[model samples]
Target: MEILTGSHERAVTTMALDGRLDALEAGQLRGILSETIERGDVNIAIDLSAVDFVDSAGLAALVKGMKDARQAGGDVKLVAPKSADAMRVFELTRFDRVFEMASELSSLVEKW
Candidate 1:
């Protein structure tokens, strides 16, 4: 997966992810999220629109990041994936209810 992260003026970290988010890439995502939180950038907006696939490991990594961010008094918001197949994972896992999601990254960024 390719991850492009940037810091916004509102102190939110915006990350745009592309490619498959599977076991091989989950660890990388987890590590980057950890580093971002460690640096006190706990409010993260992850744009998953370009991601074509997701698996269990990817879901776990995202959940972990959300929990850690919430604990730090911030939160992790997701920009819903455009792919119905990719979004099915979140729906089936009931993560759609657990996460705060938006259809557009710009919408989420505005709120943050």
Candidate 2:
């Protein structure tokens, strides 16, 4: 998988995750997000649009990233996801509220 980094609303650091986000890759994902947070980013957005799969470990990584960001007065959000099954995980965990799920970059920009 590859991470495409960009900026949204000028300040929000957006990381677009691609490929699988299962146990095998969750650690990498966590590391990337953690590094992003450590870089002093206060606003982060993860674009899961290109991610084809997500497992519980991946979800936990996302949660961990969110927690880390929040601890530093930052926030992490998830962009719109096309995988219905994976999306269910967010709803079940109430992460739908924890992370701002946007339909597109514009949706998030409008809110920001």
Candidate 3:
């Protein structure tokens, strides 16, 4: 998986993810989020539009990132997950309820 980071005016850091989010990539996700949080960028938007697949470990990594962000007085939001298989994982895990989701980055930025 590849993670690209950028910031918005609302102090929201957007991480655009590409490729599969599996066990091997889970740690990279965590590290990216950790670095963002440590930089005092607590509000995050994860752009999963390019992510075709995600496994249990990837979900765990997302959960961990959200928890860490919240603890820092911020939050993590999911955006534009176009893959059906990837969305199914979130649905099956009921993570759809746990994390705030948006169809576009603009919506999340506006809400935040």
Candidate 4:
């Protein structure tokens, strides 16, 4: 997996993930989110539109990030996954209702 990071004026950290988000990449993603929050940028926009797949470990990492960010007085907004398989994971797990999601990154960033 490839992770690209960027920042917004609203103190939101944007992370775009390319490729599959699975077990092997879960730890890395968790660490990145932790570091971003540690740096005081707790509002995060995670663009999953480019991601091809997402497994349970990947979802766990995202949940951890969301929880940590919320506790830090911010939130983690997800850019709705373009892949049906990835989207299904969120739906099946009922995480779609738990997270604030948008189809576009710009939309989430604007909300932040």
* TM-score, prediction 4: 0.98
Candidate 3 residue 2 Cα shift, in angstroms, is 1.5
lDDT of 2 by residue, 44-94 (tens): 888888777778899999999999999999788778678887687788878
- Residue ranges of candidate 1 with Cα displaced over 4 Å: none
Model 2 misses residue 63 by how many Å? 0.5
Alpha carbon lDDT of each predicted model = 0.95, 0.83, 0.91, 0.94
Ranking of all predicted structures according to lDDT, beginning with the best and ending with the worst: 1, 4, 3, 2
lDDT of 3 by residue, 1-112 (tens): 7899999998899889988999999999998889889989999999998899999999999999999999999999998579998888999989999999988888988899
Model 3 scores a TM of 0.96
For residue 34, model 1's alpha carbon misses the true position, in angstroms, by 0.2
List the pairs of residues colliding in candidate 4: none
TM value for model 2: 0.89
Worst lDDT run of 10 residues, candidate 4, spans 103-112
Query: Candidates 3 and 4: which is better by TM-score?
Result: 4
* Cα RMSDs, all models: 0.6, 1.5, 0.8, 0.6
lDDT of 3: 0.91
Candidate 2 lDDT for residue 75 = 84
Ranking by TM-score: 1, 4, 3, 2
Q: TM-score of every model? A: 0.98, 0.89, 0.96, 0.98
